[model samples]
Structures are given as structure tokens and as C-alpha cells.
Target: MSKLTKYLKITKGVRVLDLACGRGRHSIYLSTLGYKVTGADLSENSIAYAKKFENKNLTFMVHDMTQPTGKDFDTILNLFTSFGYFEKEEDNLNTLKSIKKDLKPGGRAVIDFMNVHFVSKGLVREEVKVVDKIEFHIKRWIKNGFLYKNIRFKIEDENYDFTETVKMITLEHFQKYATKSGLEIIDTFGNYNLDRFYEKCSERLIVIFK
Candidate 1:
């Protein structure tokens, strides 16, 4: 989140909210810079681990991004493809709405997600991995305009199946959602270092909006 440094030049204090902040790396860095940072995640384990770093200006909590937190924030960071996990498109839109609700009148938001236009061009269909004593067979595909990953794994004599899905959302989709959620995108970057975004080449879709 070093890219965020450029936007932190405010004369007074800044309050930042990090959505899907697993383990709270971004929150920690921002807090060190004197920003009042709050890291929120649905994973109990992640939040518990992040709480260790809590201080007067830094905190972590379990939260569902789709709901409103009712606290105004100066900056909101939704990094690492954390925006589209909901099964319903409307639920995903709610996440954006909640971000808008938490933002101060002139607050900014940054959402970093995978560039679907580029990823689709080089997508892998299948793979296998063995971690520890467990073997995992993974399959990937796109259906209904969404990307899906299926994992079949064996732990000792037990077999388990899991699936992950992302909407393959593009910049166009975000633009539509942002407008309805009262946000106006101010900039778009392609990488962590704040490079230009490309439709068929860039690796990341990082947008800074208000």
C-alpha cells in the first residue's frame, strides 16, 4: 500500500478503513504513519491475529463489508480482489454502498482487484499441488461471465471439496456500481506502484475514487 502514501498529504489527521484486511498489513503501515486505521475482515482468525497490533489509532474487527459500519472515514482501502465474493451481484453492490456510507463527504476509496481482461487471456485450466500430507486437485473455468475454481483435496483418508468464484468484473462494471453508490472515480492504476491500467495487458485493476 505504499502507493497510498501519495494520497496521505492531508494537513490534519486522517481516518482509514481497510476492508477485507486479512492479517492487517495495510492497516499496520497506515497506522504507523499516524492515520487512524481500522481493519475489518470476516475471518475470525485473521481479525484475532490483527488485534495484536491494536493501539489508540489502530484497531481490527470482524465485519461483513456488505453492511454499513456507521463510522465516517477519510480513506477506504479494499485491496486484493476483495470486492466480488458475493453470490448475488446486488450483494456485491452493497459492499460499494457500505464504503460510500463510511466515507466522509470528500473521502476517497481505493479498490484493487485482478484485471479480468488480462487474466482471461492467460488463464490456466487445471493444476495440482501437495501441501504437507494433503493433495489438492484444482480446476478453473469461466461460466456465466464469472470465474470459478474447484478444489478437490484429500487429507489422510478424508476427502473434501471447495469452490471459489469471482465475477470477472471489469472496469466497466465498477463504473456502473460506483455511480449508483455515489462515487466518482478519480484515477485508475494497473499495479501496486501505480502504473497505467491496460485492457489486455495490465495485471491489476486499481482504482481510486471518491
Candidate 2:
């Protein structure tokens, strides 16, 4: 949060929209810093959980990020690699357009995504985790320009399985998206500390734009 404040030059009372805010952690923190924040996500359960922390300065709602949530936000944040969920590139581009549409004039936005190069080079193949007496078997791999994670677990005689996929978006791809969305790329950082981004060495692809 300190690094984010520094990067955005955020001040008290600024209006912020936490887009795709899974559980409103950032929105709650920003509200505590005196910012008026609204957090929106697609998950009803996540929004319900997030609403437990709401106050006059903070709120949460269910929203689709590919569409405009609201207007005139001083800053919008899409953190924790919250993007790249859509299978279609056009939908991903539309998400960027939605962010551009929701911002106030001269408003800034941040997109924190995984460094594709770094993740591809260090992909973990498989693992098993036991939590609260449930054993989760996980497998990960990259295929057809996307990263995939498969998870299987059993609890109380029931079997659960899920697969997560995220497009391997690079800085160049984001630059193109920014141009198409009428947003200007102001800065790019490697990590939370704001180091210069190195495609292969960086752990994150953090883009600050307006």
C-alpha cells in the first residue's frame, strides 16, 4: 500500500475504484487512509464478504470488469494479476477500454500482472497440499500461449476439480492495448519497490497509466 501511494501520488479524499476487487482488501485499506473507495467484483460471495468492512468512505458491489463500473474515479486499481481471465483477446481489450471510460479526466490507473517471461521460465509442474484434512492435488503447465493450473480435491466423499487459465500477456501486449484504449503508459515497474522492469528477471509487470 505504501508503494502504491507513492506510485499514484495518492492523497486523502481521492476517489478510487478498485476494479475486480476480489475481497476488497485494497479498497478497505485505501478508505482507512482517508480515500473514498468503491470496490467491485464479479463474485457475489466475494462482494458479500467485502461488505463486512464497508463504511461511509468504502463500499463494494458486484460488477463485470469488461464493462464500465462507474465514472469519474481519480484512480483505478487492478492488482494481484486480476486481469487476463477472459479467453478472448477482444474481451481483455474491452476490459482496458472499460477502465479508460471509468476514469476521471487525467485520472491514473494501475495494472499489476505476472511477468510472463519469469513465470514461464520458473513454472512449477505439480504439488500436493493438505489443508484442514483435505488433500489438494495440483498440476501446472503452459500451453497455447496460456498458463493453466488444475486442482483436484476430495472432501466428505465428494470430489472437486477446477482449472484456472490466464493469458500470458507481456508488456508489449499491454502497450498495444493502452494505445487502443486511448490511455498513455506513464511508467512500468518490476515489483512493489518500483524497480525498473526487466522482462526476464522481474517478478511482476506493474504498469501505471492514464
Best by lDDT: 2
TM-score of each: 0.92, 0.97
Which regions of candidate 2 are displaced past 4 Å?
Answer: none
> Taking the tens digit of each residue's C-alpha lDDT, what string does model 1 give over 1-210?
554667544433688899999999988988887788999999999999999999998999899999988899988989999878888889878998999999999988989999998888999899989888677899999999899999998776888999999998999999999999989989999888788898889999998888
Residue ranges of candidate 1 with Cα displaced over 4 Å: 7-12
Best by TM-score: 2
User: Candidate 1, overall lDDT?
Assistant: 0.88
Report clash pairs, candidate 2.
none
